[model samples]
Target chain A: MPAPQKHVIGLVFYPGMTSLDMVGPHQVFGALPGVELHRIWKTLAPITCDDGLVIVPDTTFSTCPPLDVICVGGGLEQRAVVDDPEVLDFFHKQGKTARFITSVCSGAEFLAKAGLLEGYRAATHWGMREQLMTNQGVEIVNERVVVDRNRITGGGVTAGIDFGLTVASILCGEETAKMIQLLLEYDPAPPFDAGSPEKAGPELVEKAIALMQQMSSLEFANPVR
Target chain B: MPAPQKHVIGLVFYPGMTSLDMVGPHQVFGALPGVELHRIWKTLAPITCDDGLVIVPDTTFSTCPPLDVICVGGGLEQRAVVDDPEVLDFFHKQGKTARFITSVCSGAEFLAKAGLLEGYRAATHWGMREQLMTNQGVEIVNERVVVDRNRITGGGVTAGIDFGLTVASILCGEETAKMIQLLLEYDPAPPFDAGSPEKAGPELVEKAIALMQQMSSLEFANPVR
Candidate 1:
């Protein structure tokens, strides 16, 4: 009978993070009515995304409110940030109170590093699935979206749409998520059949793995975050 | 042999534009090697998207260079922007020099207004398919991504990814586009079948049409730009 209470969602944006990992879900979650969204970072200064796109943070780490949900996106810089005590501590503190703790792509690594994904089934970017498996006490599931209780995780890049819709259904309802899906015109029609390594065949997958390896090596040699 | 020259891509940004409409292609384009990317607008100011996300423009309309490719995304603001002579003229000027002039979703409407899509087969958001067909000289096709010579148009929001990859193949070659696809891990597995009107069944499509109508009306009543 009354107006729906505003739900606050905090989206973590870091230097060199993937744009689609966050923006995909941002487009979906932010479209909901009475939603309070915050793009949180250590500072309010603009942060360059993994691919050269620039995004300005809407809220500082210190000023960010206790969120109903927290989402972290992944990119080339995830390897370096896993050791940042500040980020890990923030995740630990927020994960304690947030209704749902979520991650997209390599963002799961941050949660895995923070011990949030320990003992819970999770999903990460398939390219980095091997590295994620090295994390002790975490179970890796192969799916576009993986949901275990309050911990929700989406696979790499574009999977954020599925992740957002699944979570929206849980938070709002099936009708709401479906409506948002329509609003997004989310009927995906991928022109190519080569979205995954399996679909791409061995040759393309080999090249992709080599490229990912090269990127990781470059990140270590010349860190962006 | 010297290194290949950077391919400049200027993506048009405007207030009330859909974030994913631009960000989707941006992630794909920015991932390419030697991509000199520019997020151009009328001025170098922060603009709010149709959703709540805020993005800062990287270049101004006056300062934008002769680009290899120019992309424009769409949203509720399409109606008002199509009437702006400066924007229409800017598209006209850029279309003359740019190798490829492209658009996503209702962004095709602006190109139509500018007379660039005249006599070209184009794709647009299905919800606004009728309005786009009103252009006497333009041919409206229902495909997700339509490429007629140098004019490339994508259907709806999510189609930008497909559009980007298809264009990338044209510009950089299929190998580069395929590599980028693997890197992005773009294996899309939508949990719902209701992405398009035909796929979404009659009831959902009816509701989606009504929602689109509501959003356009709301935009007219209270312009965000």
Candidate 2:
């Protein structure tokens, strides 16, 4: 027989968001038994990510049921999400009732802008951590994954896997998460040691920041639907 | 002005393929200058992955231009691909011209079925390694990333990232690949030590193999059109 109560997860998507930030966590969450995982967006249309990959949303913000967990991801396009009131409103409305509010990379910017992360210690994309600290009124952590109360945030693109496993452990216990980790072959062997600013050194980090700033300057025409 | 010659990388997608397998490499290759990354399948229609994620191919096999590299990802859906003649034909056709042929997880099965990996030493998902060895006429390499002449293969799901960076270093210089590595925050920190069969212990490995076998039995309705 089906479980009497069901758990639901809603992952938010928008144009230009880093696809890995979303899909990494999805590989963990979607594997849970009897858990309803919904890829939510403004509409059901296919959205193009920063690198030209196309992803289709499974549901819309308006039609999705009350979510147990709401997750968001970030990219250069997060600027548009920060400026969109409808998305902020959705986060706010959902934050009040959701058991956990989470983000990966700059995805936290939306929650922080929505005032959901006020006085909360969180993590963000290393490149964007300073910006979030300076303006978002939240204490920032530079670690891979940070969980303050129900607000969990992860560092840049690849941190999503760590973040996903952390979230999976919380929702379904350590054993289940460990099993998923093994299945995904979560052991990582980076051929380089430049994943973070501390490791990449100041010169390379500065170059990366400039590249990111240049990228963010490009306009994304994603309006609130 | 564009480079005199463009570098083309085509990653194949189909129903039930793992999304991360395709995307990890995409993140690396897509960042290179003058590099054209095409998500190719039989058509431009959306293909549902094993995890319910939908991906749209950028080009069709017939319309896709010549490729310097052709990549594939694997999952339970890969069995269907091995049984499809059209997909096998495409691999044989592309293998004749592509400078590099690659796969992640069980995706090597497609190339093996196409007779392209004959006498090649390759890697595949650990769970499916024995089957591949007993049947396919290819020597097996038990490692995260294996390179045998023009053929490169990665183990299991998450090895795609390392495989991607390896390929990136070959196409571009190490400096460029390292820069992309930093941009992607390629450093991974999985919270568990159970990523491999030895690490997860024999009991968990047996359980995992059973689960994988159960998963691979489901038929994917991905008719070659």
Top candidate, metric DockQ: 2
lDDT of 2 by residue, A1-225 (tens): 755246699999999989888889988787776689899889999999988899999899899888999999997776776678788888989999999999998888888888888999988777777677876688878788998888888888889989999988888877778878878877888778877777777777766666667778522211111
Q: Candidate 2 — which pairs collide?
A: none
lDDT of 2 by residue, B59-83 (tens): 9989988889999989776777677
Q: Ten consecutive residues with minimal summed lDDT in candidate 1 chain A?
A: A216-225
TM-score of chain A of each: 0.94, 0.93
lDDT of 1 at A2: 78
TM-score of each: 0.93, 0.94
Q: Which residue pairs collide in model 1, if any? A: A187-B195
Q: Which parts of model 1 have CA positions greater than 4 angstroms off?
A: A217-225, B217-225
Residue B171 lDDT in candidate 1:
80
- Cα lDDT tens digits, model 1, B1-225, are 677568999999888889999999999898777789999989877888887677888898888899989899997766667678888888889999999999998888888888899899999887767767877489988889999999999988989999999988888888888878877778887767667766666677676666667777422110111
